[model samples]
Target chain A: MKNWFRAAMAIFWKDILLETRTKDMLLAILIFSILVIVIFNFAISPTPKMIGFVAPGILWVAFILGGMFGLTRSFGLEREGGALKGLLLAPVGRDAIFYGKMAAMFTLMMVVEVIVFPVFAVLFNLSLWIPWLIPVAALTTLGIATIGTVFSAIAMNTRAREIMFPLLFLPVAIPTIIAAVETSGVAIRGVELAEMSRWIPFMGAIDAVFLVICPVAFNLIIED
Target chain B: MDDKPAIEINGLTKSYGRTGVLRGLDLKLDWGEVITILGSNGSGKTTLINIIGSLTKPDSGTVEFGGIGVRARATSIRRFIGVVTHEHLLYEHLTGYENLRFHADLFGISSADERIIIVARQLGVEARLNQLVGTLSHGTQKRIAIARALLHDPPLLIMDEPESGLDQEAQGMLDGVIRQLAESGCTVLTTTHNLDKGTAMSRRIAILREGRIVYDEDLKSSTGADGVKKAYASHSGESM
Candidate 1:
C-alpha cells in the first residue's frame, strides 16, 4: 500500500516537472480559452442584464471547449516515445498510474480554469464573484479530469483519437457540464450557498462514482 | 533462484483476431544463461519475447519467472525484470538523467542517482545525462535506453534487437556490459537477426519458425556456430 502511493507520486512529480520545463500544454489551452473569450466578447453585447442571464452559458462553453482541447492531448505525452509502456513496466499498480495521471490532469485543468475564470469575468462583466463557486469548480473539474483521463487513455488507442474522444466523452460529460452551468448560474445570480448546495451533491456524486469505476476500467483496458 | 528456472513457459498460445501469433510453444532458461532468439519477420519472435517480458498476456498457457507466474504476478515480477524493446520507452521531454531517475524511483531503489550515474558511465552516456532524450541522436538515445534498463541491476534482462540503432562503439560497450551482467548471474533473453553476433553474444541459440522454436542448441562443440547457422538457414529459410 505504501509502495503504491509512492509510485503514484513519482509519476505525478515527473509530469509536473516535464510541464514546468516545456510550458507548451498549458500555454496552448490557455491561448484557446482566451481566444474563445475574446471572440465571445466581440460576438455578444454584455449588458448588465445580459451578463447575468447569459454569463454561465458563455463561460461554460469556453471552459468545456478549452478543457476538451487540453484533455485531447493529455495522453500524447505518454504516447510519445512509448513512455506509456515504460510506465506499465515500472512495477506500479494500475490504480497508481490512473490516480497519478488524473491528479495531473486535474491540476492542469484547474490551472486553466483559475486563469480563465478571472479573464472570463473581466470580459463577461461578471463582477459579482463569490467564494461558493470554488467548490463548484473543484467538483466539476474533478469530474472532467476523472472521465477525461479515462477517455484520454481509451481514445489514445484509436487511430482517430481527436475525433473519438469527444464522440465518446461528450455524452457522458454533458450532464456534469449542465449541472455545473446551472449551479454556477445560481451563484452568478447572487443566490445563497444553501440554494447551490443541492446541485453540488449531484456533481460530487458523478465524480465519486466514476472515480471508483475508471481505475478498474483503466487496469483492464491497459495492454500492448 | 538456482533451484528454479529463471524463465519457464509451456503450452503458450496467442492470436490477434483470426491470426495466430504463437502456437503451443514452450521454452525455459536456467539462472545466469544468455539466450538469443532468431526468426523471420512473422515467426512470432516478438510475441514470444513480449510474453516472457510480461508486456502482453497469452490467450492461454502459463509463464513463470523464478517460481512466480508472469501473468498473475506481473507487478511483483517486474520489480526484478528490465525490458528494452525496439522503442526506447523513454520520455523525450525529460532529460536522460530525469528519465533514469524516475524509473529508479518506481523500482524503489535507494541512492538512485548514484546507480544511474554508474550505469550511465558504463554505457558511455554520462556526459549527455543532462540533455533531453529527444534531442539526442539515435545511438546516444539507444545508449541511454540501455543505461535505463541496467540502472536497477535487475536479475533478469530482456531486450529485443538491442543493437539495431547503436553505433559500433556503443555496441561493443553493450557486449561488454552484457558479459559483465552475465558474470554477475543475470539471466538474459534477447532477439537478433545477425547470426555471427548472436553466436558470439549468447550461450544458446533458438530459431523460431511458424510460431514454434524449431532449433535450440548450445555452442559447445567446435563446429557449433556453423551447425547453428546451417540449422537457422534450414529453419527460417533466410540467409544472413
Candidate 2:
C-alpha cells in the first residue's frame, strides 16, 4: 500500500509538472472557459430575477466545456510517443495509475476553478459568502475529472480522439454536472449547506461509484 | 533463490477473430540465459511478446513467471519482467532526466536524483539528460528507453528488435550494452531478423515461420551453408 501511494504520487507530480511547463491543456481550457462565460454574460440579458433562473445552467456550461477540454488533452501526448507502454512496464499496480491520473486531473480542474470563480463572482454580482463553497467547488471538480480522465484515456486509443471525448463524456456525466450546478447555485444564492443535503449525498454517490468503476475499467481498456 | 524457471509457457495460443495467430506454443526459459527469436513480419512475434509481457492476455494456455501464475498474480509478476519493444516508450515532452526521475519515482525508489545520474552516465546519456526526449536522436531515445527499463533491474528483459532504426555505430554500442546487461546476470530475450547480430549475441536461436517454431538450435554448433539452407527449407515445408 505504501509503494502504491508513492507510485501514484509520482505519476501525479509528473502530470502536473508536464502540464505546468507547457500550459497546453490549461491554456486551452482557460480560453474556452472564459469565452464560455463571456458569451453567456453578453448573449443572455441578465435581469435580477433571471440571474437565479440561468446562472446554474451557465456555470454548468463552463464547467462541462472546460472539463472536456481537459479530458481531451490529458492522455494525448502519452499515447503519441508510446509513454503509456512505459507506464505499463513499471512495477506499480494498475490502480495506482488510475488514482494518479485522477489526482492530476483534479489539480488541473482546481486551478481552472480558482480562475473561473472570481470572474464568476464579479460577472454575476452574487455574494457567495460561504467559505465552504470553495471546498464544494473542489469536490465537484474532482467528480468531473475523476470520470473524465478514464474516458479520455480510452478515447486516446481511438482514431478520432478529440471528437470522441466530449461525445462520450457529456452523455454519461450529465447527472453529476446538473447536481454540481444546482448545489453550487444554491450556495451562491445564500442558501444554507444543509438545504443541499439531498443533492450532496447524490454527489458523494457519484464520486464513490466512479472511484471504484474507473480503475477497473481503465485496466481493461489499457490492455493491448 | 530457488531453482525456478524464469519464464514458462504451456500451450499458449492467440487468435484474431477467425484467424489463428499463435497455436499451442510452449517455451521454458531459465534465469541468466540469452535467447534470440527470429521470424518473418507477421509470424506472431509481437503477439508472443505481448502475452509474455502481460500487455495482452492469451486466448488459451497458461504462463507462469518464476513459479507464480502470470494470469492470477499479474500485478506481482510484473516486478520480475521488463520489456523493450520497437515503440519509443519515452515521453517526448519530458527531459531525459525528468523521464528517468519519473520512472524511478514510479518504482518508489528514494534518492532518485543520484540513481538517475548514475544510470544516465552508464548509458552515455549524461550530456543529454536535460534535453527533451523528442529532440534526441533515435539512438539516444533508444538508450533512454533502455535506461528506463533497467531502473528497476528486473531479472527478465524482453526486447523486440532493439537495434531497429539505429546506425551502424549505434547498433554496435547497443550490442555492447546488451552484452554488458547479460554479463550482469540479467536474462535477455530478444527478437531480430539480423542473423549475424542474433547469432553473436545469443547462445540459442529459435527460428519462427508462419506463427510456429520451425527451428530451435544452439548457434555455436550450427555450421556453414547447409545449416542456413536447411533451416529456411524446413520452415518453408520443402525438403532440401
Candidate 3:
C-alpha cells in the first residue's frame, strides 16, 4: 500500500511539474471555459429569471467542455516522447498509474473550476457562496476526472483521437453530468441541503461506482 | 550468480494480424553474459525485446526469468528487468534530471539522487542533466535513456538498437557501460544492425532472420567482425 501511494504520488508530481512548466492544459481549459461563459452571457439576456433558469446548464456546459479539453490533453505529455511506455515498464501496479492520472486531472479541473466559478456567479448574478456548493462541485468533478482519465488513456492511441474521446466519454458521463447540473441548480438557488439530499446521494453513488471501476478498466486497457 | 539461466525463451510466438513476427523462437542467457542479436529489417529483433520487456504478449510459449515464467509473474518479473528501446521514453518537456528522478521514484529506488548522479556521470551526461530532453540532441537523449534504464540496478538489461544515434564517443561510453554491467554479473540482451560493434561488445552474437535465430556464434570461437558479417550474410541471404 505504501509503495502504491509512493508510485502514485511520483506520477502525480511528474504531471504537476510538466503542466507547471508548459501551462498548456491549464491555459486551454481556462480559455475555452471563459469563451463558453462569455458566449452564453451574450446568447442569454441578463434578466434575473433567464439567468436563474439557464445558469445551471451554462455553468455545467463550461465545466464539461473545459473538462473535455483538459481530458483530451491529459496524456499529451506522455504521448509526446512515448513516456507512457516508461511508466508501464516500472514495477508499480497499474492501479497506481490510474490513480495518479486521475488525481492530476482532478487537480487541474478544480483549478479551472475555482477560476470559472466566480466568473459564473458574476455573469449569472447567482449566489454560489452556499456551503453545499463546495461539496457538490467536488463530487461532480471527481466523477468527471475518474471517468475522463480512463477514456483519455483509451483514446490516446486511436487514430481519430480528437473525435474518439467525446464519443467514448460523453455517453458514460451523462449520469454524472445530470447529477452535477441538478445539484448545481440547487446550490445556485440556495436550496437547503435536505432539498438536495436525494440528488447529492445519487451523485455520490455515481462517483463511487466509477471510482471502483475506472482503475480496474484502466489496467485492462493498458495491458498488452 | 546462480546456476539458473537469467532469461529463457521457448517456443515463443507472436503475430500481428496474419503477419507472424516471432515464430517458435528459443534463446537463453546465463547470468553475467552479454548477448547481442544482429538482424536485418523486419527480423523481429524489437518484437522479441518487447516481449521480454513485458510490453507485449506472445501468442504462445513461455519466457522465464530466473526459472519463473513471465506470464505468471509479469509485475514481479519487471522489477528485475530494465529496458531501453529506440524511443527515449523520457518526457520531452522534462529536464534530464527530472526524468531520471521520476523513473527512480517509480522503481522505488531509495537512493535515487546518488544513483542518478552515478549513472549520469558514467554515461557522460552529467553536464546535460539540467537540459530539457527535447532540446538535446538524439545522442544525448539516448544517454539519458540508458541512465534511466540503469537507475534500478536491474539484473537483466534489454535494449533495442542502443547505438542507433550515438556518436563515436557516446558509443565508446556505451561499450564501457555494457562491459561494466557484464562484469557486475548482469545479463545484457541487445539488438543492433551494426555487426562490427555488436560482435565486439557481446560475448555471444546471434543473427536473426525471418523471425528465427538462424546463426549464433560465440565471439570466443569466431574470428572477428568478418566472421559475424559472413555468418549474417550467409544466414540472412543479404550482403553487408
Clashing residue pairs for model 2 = none
- Residue A29 local lDDT, model 2: 81
| Count of residue pairs whose backbone atoms collide, per candidate | 0, 0, 0
In candidate 1, clashing pairs total 0
lDDT of 1 by residue, B1-240 (tens): 568899998989999899999998889999999999887778887788788878888999889999788888888888889888888889999999999999998888899989998999899999999999999998998888888888888899999888889878878888998999999999999888778888878879988778887888888843599988999888876674
Candidate closest to the true structure, highest TM-score: 3
lDDT tens digits, residue span A135-206, model 1: 888998899888888899999899999899999888889889998888888888887678677898989898
Q: Once superposed on the true structure, which residue ranges of model 3 sit more than 4 Å away at CA?
A: none
Q: What is the Cα-based lDDT of residue B203 in candidate 3?
A: 74
Q: Candidate 1, residue B170: CA error in Å?
A: 1.1
Q: How does residue A97 of candidate 1 score in lDDT? A: 94
TM-scores, each model vs. reference: 0.97, 0.94, 0.98
Models ranked on lDDT: 3, 1, 2
Candidate 3 interface RMSD after superposing interface residues: 0.8
Error of 1 at B188 (Å): 0.6
Candidate 2 CAPRI-style tier: medium
lDDT for each residue of candidate 3 in B1-240, tens digit (9 for 90 to 100): 266799999989999999999988999889989999998889999999989988899999899999988868887788899999999999999999999999988888998899999999999999999999999999999999999999999999999999999999999989999999999989999999878888877979998888888877887787766888888889877777
